[model samples]
Target: MRQTSYFHTVIIGAGAAGMMCAARTGQGGKSVALLDHAVKIGEKIRISGGGRCNFTNRNLNGHDGSPYYVSQQPRFVRYALSRYTAQDFMHLLDKYGIAYHEKHKGQMFCDDSAQAVVEMLQNECRLGSVTWYTGCTVESLTALPIAPAGYEQARFGINTDQGLFYCRNLVIATGGLAVPAVGASPFGYEVAKQFGHHIIPPEAALVPLRFEKWAEQGFDTLSGIALPVRISTGSGKQAVVFDEDLLFRHKGLSGPAVLQISSYWQPGRHIMVNLVPDTDLAEVLCRDKVGKKIQLKTALKQLCPVLPERLIDFWLGREPFQAVAGQKWADIPNALLQQLGQSLNHWTVLPTGSDGHKKAEVTRGGVDVKEINPKTMQSKQCEGLYFIGEVMDVTGWLGGYNFQWAWASAVCAAEALRADEHI
Candidate 1:
């Protein structure tokens, strides 16, 4: 018979949320067990933000009912987020002397390395005396018929490669299927399903958009070119827009703009991009055509000085512009120039698909938030079963919003778990 390890709380997936919850719960004097199949934990944190880790966003309004997050229940994040704001996480960082700096739009990244954040979480776990079960696979999990002798409220029996762990609370922080190379799995969703909870169909989000016939469209040659653009998907109330840098990739569109809009994008929907966001391309082209004796291409290059020469060449080489390429700007009709401007301003393209989970920074959907209690991060149907972080349906915008959700939701769950012990 395998020896049973009884803990007040048993949390799975030792990534961001799991670590945070374990540290808090253990510190609150609850016996905690943190488990993961990965040999090295925090791989996601280590590789985020080009290795520095965009830990959280400062612009997150924990109080003002901001819609920075996406979910079926969009307002579900309010309570937890307000309960544990980004400033609270920063305070934790400040306590550890972890040097961090804001990059842009309130995105915060570590100054040295993301490894430091991982180490800090590990140290916090150690301070709380949380047991570590790294590289341990859970074979099966069963709800206990009766509470264990010492742990009167223990309701879960988790059988793992390490041993059987009985706990009063079970937290599924296994995260979502984003970067599968870092050990992302469906374990959390599976657990949620087993507990009679609903899961929103998961999709790759914060990933690059890939177009069909990308090379045929002449985008292949403009791979390294990047420009400030306004990108949008959908329309009206459903329309999502971002004014950020757009990068041309060998396969498709990427960079901050594409990644942000990708979250709201759906198949069969065309995305529109204003290549010259700051200037009205049509007005400028028609106005500049008045006296310029330069070739149409040169006029375009001179007018949109922000665009790279390679992109201008590529743009002029395509469609209606191809015929007017060699014509003098003064010789070209205002109507054609205006048409050229319209094309540049409203460049609409349909993305065939995305780079998928392999390249996605985060997963868009998971265990449905509607089925989880916002205040406690606990399941509405299952007692003592909690879900937090990316594993839940709440996904944030690009930058550091997702990390803020992870921290906020984890702390909320941890606090609830701690309070439950006394009850």
Candidate 2:
């Protein structure tokens, strides 16, 4: 590229992690520069949580960790999260006087707007005096030979219209390819590849799913239906059961349950849904014999009125698979009835596909976390290179887990880098 330039640290992506890192590093008396290709900063933050921005969750249970991440190295996120918890995030929110309320299942959201959260982060960066450039892009990166201090004097001499600015440290907090309109690009993954880091193959997540039209006419009719469900995928190796509203859309399914479970789901695999979750299917049926003997369609319709009658008719069949579809619950062969029970208890239906990146809430599979230090978000292999937020492989469940990861990783890296006087 052009003649290499220089700086103490350069952070890419003006999202939460980058902002946090910049603010912290700057506070430590280090000169930090932040950049973003987008015209606006924190686009994801602005639109998250239905615009209210569910900033963090109280559901960060120490007893359970993996629920928040699926990584090539599963342990990668544990260290970062341990160092910085959701409560720390709330402190920052409080510092800004950003009023938030605890909603369902411990999710905390701003009562006003997501913009408030973004502005608070921006204000933090400003207070730290971290410089920033918007509507900018990186042309390329290459490493230099290791310097005398054991840590190499590596340089990322990025080419931008503003000028060629090189940095001893480079942090990628560009986030994932969830919403391209917000300037979420594959640039982060490409940078990781440039540094010889492996990628976990990214895909759109936390989005609605669309079923094939021909076989799903009945399902399509339930455009406004919603219900609680426990969905499973990957045959069983990966599954999530969430009791939340699953709203029907013209395309497919959406809402909390589907969004939470979608992270674990893969293509071409059956997604098992528990219509009446937890309770034994036989017990539920036996609870009312007369109800059991009712038409299979009628029973399913009764079980979940939110579901369309036509869908029940299609699944229960006019003969319950082997017999007539509308056979009485008692007339339904015991063996076949068992199959229906199995279908309800462990209903398996593979989705045609999910909504792509354009509508995805978050991205699954990003920069492999193994290449980075969990404690500080720094690259173990490449000095001065840190990967944080959704740019790394650490993802979270539907709630505010991902944002929590961002704040945690950023704080960790910023603190660590600030501690380093070498810069």
Question: TM-score, each model?
Answer: 0.97, 0.87
Who wins the TM-score comparison?
1
lDDT, candidate 2, at 42: 89
lDDT of 2 by residue, 1-423 (tens): 443345578898999789988988888888888998888888889999989998888876443455567666777777777777778888888888989999988898999999998888888888888888898867766665543243344366677866777677888889999989888899899989988899989988888877787234566656676667676666445545667777767777888877777777777777777766755555555445454567756665666665556556556543346354666765655566566667767866667888889999889998877778778888877887888899888778877888888888998998888877666
Q: Global lDDT of each model?
A: 0.90, 0.77
Candidate 2: residue 25 lDDT (0-100): 86
Q: How does candidate 1 fare on TM-score?
A: 0.97
| Candidate 2 colliding pairs | 6-166, 293-329, 293-330, 317-325, 318-324, 318-325, 318-326, 319-323, 319-324, 319-325
Q: In candidate 2, how many clashes are counted?
A: 10
- The C-alpha local distance difference test score for the whole of candidate 2 amounts to 0.77
